[model samples]
Target: MKKLMLGNEAIARGAYEAGVRVATAYPGTPSTEITEFAAQYDEIYAEWSPNEKVALEVAIGASFAGARAMVAMKHVGLNVAADPLFTVSYTGVNAGLVIVVADDPGMHSSQNEQDSRYYARAAQVPMLEPSDSQEALDFVKLAFDLSEEYDTPVLIRLTTRVAHSQSIVALGQRADVPLKEYRKLPEKNVMMPAMARKRHGEVERRMKALAQAANDLWINRIEMGDTSIGIIASGIAYQYAKEALPNASFLKLGMVNPLPRKLVESFARKVEKLYVIEELEPVLEEQIKSWGIAAIGKEIFPVQGELSANMIAERIAGKALDVRPAQDLPPRPPVMCPGCPHRGIYYVMQKLRLHATGDIGCYTLGALPPLKAIDTCVCMGASVGMAHGMEKARGRDFSSKLVAVIGDSTFIHSGITGLIDVVYNQGASTVVILDNSTTGMTGHQDHPGTGRTIKGDLVPPLNLINLIKAIGIRHVRVVDPFELEEVEKVLKEETQREEPSVVIAQRPCALLSKESKIPVSISEDACRLCGVCLRLGCPAIEKKPGGMYINQTLCNGCGLCVKVCKFGALRRAGE
Candidate 1:
């Protein structure tokens, strides 16, 4: 059967057909949907692990149990799972194991545009790059076969465009491969120094074999056209290159790492001019050049952002296509929703002039004006450690003016270890956990504290307060973020303490709340236009020539603005 599917959905379909028994991942964009789609199949046991490290570990355990297993995550998430990844390369796997990492070349929904192909090289694993949904499906099944055959894990790299784009995929039947028997082979499975030394040599031999086999691999093919210009590309870049230079000879590589050197050399010899087209980093260009092959890449093309057909045409073909430039529009920076619970906490923080070390999540929006509350945002769980570091650097008194802000899901991901460090080291820092009841930034996915699984199965929720107390934080306070006065009160008290403290601002995300919204209104007669309410930065409030008016259409009637206004200017609709 044939059907239209997203590259992510196609990957899930491929896993189901490949007889994958287990799947795991942390919720991250460009990769989240892969596991979510896999969860629908009754044959696969899918889960949302706390973080990429735990997710990879779960998949590893499943693989060791002699079952086909897969794990998916975004490019940056690979960094989190790298610790396990490097060692797992030496141990190999009992059953087939595949890791799908989606790269965001344009930083569309990510903090960085990291190319994941380099990971495959560093881990000495075979990497597959799929161009479209069809290739995505095919490559996954192929990756599993390669993993077991070589006794090593496999990587399938997907870019933002290919991952989100749709294409028709030819479906296949499930393979129904029986689980292999697990044996206590300490020499092969255990990674003691002596055993690791032996496995390291095996990893090197496997790479050599895979490189030789890649020459005959069906996915890596050369399309002969006009021999004037030949472009070597993979993943989405291949799609762009094909559109830009349709008549040019092309060498499309489905297996990117341990590159088919003979195939690349043969193609290079055939064409007069060769260009390596890829996005983000010069990973392909650097390695290919290291082999003393003359190729053009990153010199004429950009190293930053995504590549487009227009760029390829202009640079390689020297033809100006009649593509209209997008008309400049007014900049609409992302802001907190009208009724966002996070807004109240940021307002209180700004009022108190507290320095907030922020972590990843929607609350990072607090760094934007009119709140301007967050001081630094490095990565997930960095806030807790950074806040503690600042206190130790300056003095105990300095901690009184500093705070660390993180979301509930993020806290569970990596912040808990940082919090434990604070207590163990005898440091005084204020940590604020914004319990928004969902992973807000990634389409409201469930987490450990959500009391639900990826399939929305009811489970016992992890108690945040109890966890904090157990972490040695004695002064723990829970406040409704919607209640601005209460939030402010808690912040003032928590920041004044001389020991580690936690304040969990508990509220359901505005989008998740099914409560009726009675949009608030501005009392025109009592309006002073002092711009106090405007400081909240809610999208519902609009500034005009005459005065400030509440855009009722955008307001969710949370009355946060009403509390911020000194005068009786803002109130619920109809008084």
Candidate 2:
């Protein structure tokens, strides 16, 4: 049967049909939906692990137990999982293991445009790139096959465009693949120095064989056309190239890591001008050039963001194509939603004029304008460590004026380690836990503290207050972040404390919490056009010509702005 499916959903379906028994991943953009979709299939045991490293470990354990396992994460998440990735190459796998790393170009929800194909090259693992949903499905099934055939973990690289885009896919029944019985082959699975040295030679041999096999692989195909211009492309770049250079010949490569050199040389001989048109990085261009072949890439094409048909066409045609002119719409940057629990905490932080070392999650929005509560955001758990480091370097005065804020999910991901460093180092750094009850940034996936597992099974919730107290934190307090007075009082008190302190700004995210029916409004007669309410940075509150207005639909009736107004100007519309 054929069905229209998102590339992520198709990959999940392919995994299911390939008889994948175990699947795990941490929630991250462009890659989060894959696990969410996979969870819907009854045949696969899917989960949201605490972080990428744990997720890969879970999948590795499953593979050791002779189950076909798959792990998924975004490009940066791989940085956390890299420790096991390189080692696993030498350890190999009992069952076929496929790891999906979705790369985000254009910084779409990412901090950086890291090319994950480099990781494939670094780990000595084969990598696959699929252009659309059909190939996403096909390649996942092929990845599993290749993984076992090569006795190595396979990496499937998905970018934002291919991961999110929809295409028609042919569905298949589950393959009757049985679980391979586990055998404790120390020489193969264990990575002692002697075994690792042997496996290293094996990995090198495997790569050479894979490269030779890649020349004949059906995934790498040559389309004959006008030989004057030949383009070598992969993933969404190939799609863009096909749309732009319709008349030009294409060497569309689906297997990108161990590039097909024989096929490349054959195609280059057929065409007059050779061009490598992959996106984000010149991975192919660099490799092709190393092979003593001349190609045009990165020099004329951008090494960032996405590639569009018009951009490719314009460059190929040597003139701007008749395309839709760009629109000058006012930029609509993403902001925290109305009645977001994090807002009140950030507002209090800004009011106190403190430097907030920040961590990843929705609270990162605090770094945005108007609030601007956050100062430095390096990674998942750098906040607490950074706060303590600053105290050690700059002395008590600076530490007293500094704060660190992190979300509940992020705190569990890696922030706890940072917190331990602060408490152990004799630093008087005040760390604020933005306990919003869910992983707000990554579409509210369940975490350890959320009282529910990814499979919707109930679990004991981690008590943040008790956890802090047990950590030897003398000043541990929990306050509703929506309560402005409490939030301000706690921030002021904690930052001034002599000992290391923890303030848990506890509130459910407005989107996850049961919402109030009543919406807020401005009393024009009482408003006085003071614009103090605007300071809250809530999208529900906006300015009009005659007076201030609140979008009743957008307002959650949290009355955050109402609490901010000293003039009794803002209130619930009914009140």
lDDT of 1 by residue, 203-255 (tens): 99999999999999999999999999999999999999999889999999999
The total number of steric clashes, by the backbone 3 Å criterion, in model 2 comes to: 0
- Per-candidate clash tally: 0, 0
The list of candidate 1 runs beyond 4 A from truth reads 322-328
- All candidates: TM-score: 0.98, 0.98
Q: Model 2, 11: alpha-carbon shift in Å? A: 1.0
**What lDDT score belongs to each candidate, Candidate 1 first?**
0.92, 0.90
Candidate 2 achieves a global lDDT of 0.90
lDDT (Cα, tens digit) per residue for candidate 2, span 465-492: 7887777888988898888888888888
Off by over 4 Å in 2: 322-329
